[model samples]
Target: MTRVQANLLLLVIALIWGSAFVAQAQGMGVIGPMMFTGIRFLVGALVVAPLAWREWQQLNAQQRAPGRREAGKITALGVLMLMGAAMQQIGIVHTSVTNAGFLTALYVPLVPVLGIFFHRHWPHWSVWPGGLACLVGAFLLSGASSLQIGVGDAWVIASALPWAVHVLMVGRVADKMAAPFCVASGQFFVTGLMALLWALAFEPATLQAVQAAAWPILYTGVMSVGVAFTAQVVAQRYAHAADAAIILSSETVFAALFGYWMMGERLSPSGLAGCSLIFISMTLIQLIPVLKRRYS
Candidate 1:
């Protein structure tokens, strides 16, 4: 596919993820966050397993079966996913999806900062300014102005840390693997199993509860995880890193829009300004380095 097509695919993935925020919030009405996450990821794994199996077969035919190390990385990625997803789910129950969406985008600037500790690498110059903007924007967006941030907003902010790690790990590990689908499936299964363990132990998930949350489970599982993630893996191959990052960030805007329409969530004028700053700074942080690299 051409770069344009690849970028378009990324945009679609953003839309799916943006709207999935609504489903996620709604899912918790009758079930625990852990239970909702557990069933959702399990469904995602089932939906994507066939594609992973096909790739596994292809790898076997080529005599290049991915090693146990890759498997381990996939498992690690799953753990990160579980952490991020669980916190976000829990936070959404207490906060608006709009807040959750915008706050979650905090992970974008964070990915590079995480590189400092984990990868022993510094980020681009833009990250410093962008990071500062994000800090202020988050303060406004999540209503920390009154010196009393909501519990849910704090939880969502906390989730950004693992998500930052997950993004870095996916680039470090998943991109190196031959089969993106296999990596996606493996991680989904790991997250599902882990969350299921927690849910069975602590959360009471009955047939009634499951039935009540069934639509959300399927929407997030099938659309968000299965299709959007797979499409992202595929699209990134043909997309410019700058364009991909910028386009993927649109999910936050989509999330806010969906939250307003479906959940009737509204951000104050300060919050809207906060969103704009976050978006602009993030785009520049991602785009500037790519442009410098191209023009040198």
Candidate 2:
């Protein structure tokens, strides 16, 4: 896919993720965070498993081998994914919603910085300003008057590191393997299996709890984890990792919109301004590279 098309797919994924925030939130009320995360992603894995098998069938003899190094990378990616998901689920409980929202956006800038520092990959210049703007906008959109450090806040902050790494790794693995569905399925299963183990060890899981959270679990599993994450893996093949981060960060904007519509949450003037800046910044990031290609 073209970069633009890939980015548009990321935008759609953001929308789905944003809308699922309510489901995620409600899910936490009745289910343990680990249990909810484990079940949802396990469902997602099952949903995508058939497609992964199909992709496996088409691979040549060499590609089908599941090299040890590649398997290690995929396993690490799954651990990162589980870490990100589990942290956010746990963190949002003790922190203010605004704090959680603002802190989660930290990954936008972290993606490129990590790439540059470790992977020796430099992002386009526009990514710098655009990413910072998105960060600021996320802060504003979060509606936080002051930054406070708390247990939940710290968890949320920590989540950003794994999330940023996961994004970078996803692009690298997809590029190396050229099998998006397989990567997606493998990560989902790994994440789910690990999370379930954690849940069983620490959290109480019962049929009643699962039934109470069933809709939220099913929606998030099928739509957010299964479809959206899979598409993200596919799209990241063509989209720059840094640029994709900026686009995916628009999930906070979508979250606000969904909150307003479904939960009667209202956006203030500052929130609206933050939303505008986010839109403008994303546009600039996406447009600059296109312009460079066209004019150069």
Candidate 3:
């Protein structure tokens, strides 16, 4: 795909993810987080199965056989995905959809920060300033002026760490593997299995609850996880990672818009400030280097 096409795909993926936050929040009203996550990912796995199989068929024997290294990466990705998804799902029960969307976008900033430990590298100078902006935005968004954060908001913020880790891990795996669709499918299956296990252990999941959540679950699984994730993998191949991240971060804006339009949700003044700061920080992270290069 051309760069323009790839970026547009990322934009579409962002819209899917953003709008799905509303579905996720609504789904939580009918089922526990674990059950919702389990069913959604299970549906996603099924949706992507055919594409994964096609990708597998094109690979040679050696590549088809999962290596220890690749297996480890896939497992790690699945674990991170589960953690992030579960946290976000649970968080949705307590927070506004707008809060969930903005808080989740904190992952865009956290990605480079987490690299310090995992990749043994420091972030750019721009990241520090941007990180500060995100922190302030988060503080305002959480309504911390009252010296308290809602439980769901806290959980969403906590989930950003794992989300960042997942993003970096996906990039690494994408570079090494020829078959993005297969990797995406495998991770979805693994996440689904683990989430189902969690649900069975702690949540009172039932057929009735699943039926109640069916539409939201199906929409999230089919459009958000299956199609959006596959599109991300394909688009990233043609677009620079920084540019892709910037476009994808627009998901937060889309989420807020969807939340407002569909549910009549509105953010408080502090919340709007938080969203604005977070967005400005995201833009700075991507724009700084370009400006530096151009002026230098």
Q: Taking the tens digit of each residue's C-alpha lDDT, what string does model 2 give over 156-221?
A: 999999999988879779778888888898899999999999999999889999999999999999
Residues 111-136 of candidate 3 have per-residue lDDT tens digits of 66666677776656876676667666
Q: For model 2, what is the alpha-carbon lDDT of residue 160?
A: 98
Q: Judge candidate 2 at residue 133 and give its lDDT.
A: 98
Residue 203, model 1: Cα distance from true site in angstroms: 0.7
Instruction: Choose the strongest candidate by lDDT.
Output: 2
Candidate 2 vs 3: which has more lDDT: 2
Alpha carbon lDDT at 54, candidate 1: 96
Report how far off residue 79 is in candidate 2 (Å). 0.2
lDDT of 3 at 257: 70
Query: Residues 125-201, candidate 1, lDDT per residue (tens digit)?
Result: 77677666765665566554444349998998999888777666664464567688888888889998999999999
> Order of candidates by TM-score, top first?
2, 1, 3
- C-alpha lDDT values of all predictions: 0.78, 0.91, 0.78
- Report the error of model 1 at residue 89, Å: 5.3
- Flag clash pairs in model 3: none
lDDT of 3 at 186: 83
Q: For every model shown, what is its TM-score relative to the native structure?
A: 0.82, 0.95, 0.81
- Name the best candidate (by TM-score): 2
Which ten-residue region of model 2 has the weakest summed lDDT?
59-68
